[model samples]
Target: LSDRLSRRVGMIVPGLAGMAVMAAVLGAAGWLPDGAALVTLVAAWVLLAIPDGLHRSSASALVVEQSPAPSERGRFMGALGACGALASVLAPVTYGFTAQAAGIGCTFLLSAVSLVLALGCVSRVREASSPATPE
Candidate 1:
C-alpha cells in the first residue's frame, strides 16, 4: 500500500506519515479519557504504523532521487541506514528517560512536537529541491 502511494506521491508520502505521527502522538498525550484511553492508544498505534510503512518505502526512493550519482547512492543509503539505526536505538531510550522524568503524557507531547518539526524540515527540503519555473 505504501509502495503504491510512494510511487504516486513520492516524498509527500513521508510528509503525510510525519503528519500522521504527529496526530497519533498528540492523541496519545492525554487527549482521551480513562475509558477511552485504550481505544485511543490502539488507534494511535495504527496511525504510527502507517508512517512506519510509508517511511520504509519512501526513504529508499528518496535516496535514489536525491543522490547525485549512482556511485554515491550506496554511501548515501548507508549513512541513511546508520542514522535510522541510531535513531531507533536512541529514541526509545530517550523516551523512556523522558517519560520517567516528565511523565508519559509530556513525553508524547514532546514526540508530537518533534514530529511537527520534522514535517517542517521535510517541507523545506522538498521546496528547495523542486525545480523552478520561469515567471
Candidate 2:
C-alpha cells in the first residue's frame, strides 16, 4: 500500500502542478463570479481529468507492448480499474466537503499544499517513512 501510494503521489504531481498554476492565474485575474466560477470549476475538473484519460491510454499501450500472459494481463488491468473506481468514489466527496468548508480557492490551496508535501517526501526520506494514515 505504501509503495502504491508513493507511485500515485508521483502521478498526481504533474496534474496538480498544472492545477495550481491555473488556479493562481484565475485568482490573479479576478475571474471568479457566480456563473464564471462554476464554469471555471468545471473546466478545472476537465483539465484534471486529462491525466486520467492519458493514464488509460498509457495502460492500454502497456498491455499491448508487454503482451502479457492472458490471465495476468486481465488481472492487472482489473486491479488498476478497481483502484481507479475507488479514487472516483472518494475524491469528489473529499473535495466537495473541503470546498464547502473552505471555499474552492482554499481547496486549490490545500491541493497545492498536498502536492508540495508529497514532493517533499521524496526529497526527505523522513517524511516518506511516516504513513499518511488519514484521520
TM-score of each: 0.73, 0.45
lDDT for each of the candidates? 0.64, 0.52
Tens digits of per-residue lDDT for model 2 on 1-135? Answer: 222444234443344455555554434323466787777766766675665443345444343333345446667777767977998898688879987886656656666565556445433422234323322
Candidate 2 regions off by >4 Å? 1-52, 63-68, 109-135
- How many backbone clashes are present in model 2? 0
List, residue by residue over 6-115, the lDDT tens digit for candidate 1.
Answer: 33256454655565565556546466677687777766766676666665666566665667766787798899899889999998999899878877777777667777
Clashes (backbone N, CA, C under 3 Å), per candidate, total 0, 0
What is the Cα-based lDDT of residue 29 in candidate 2? 29
In terms of lDDT, the poorest run of 10 residues in model 2 is: 126-135
Pairs that collide, model 1:
none
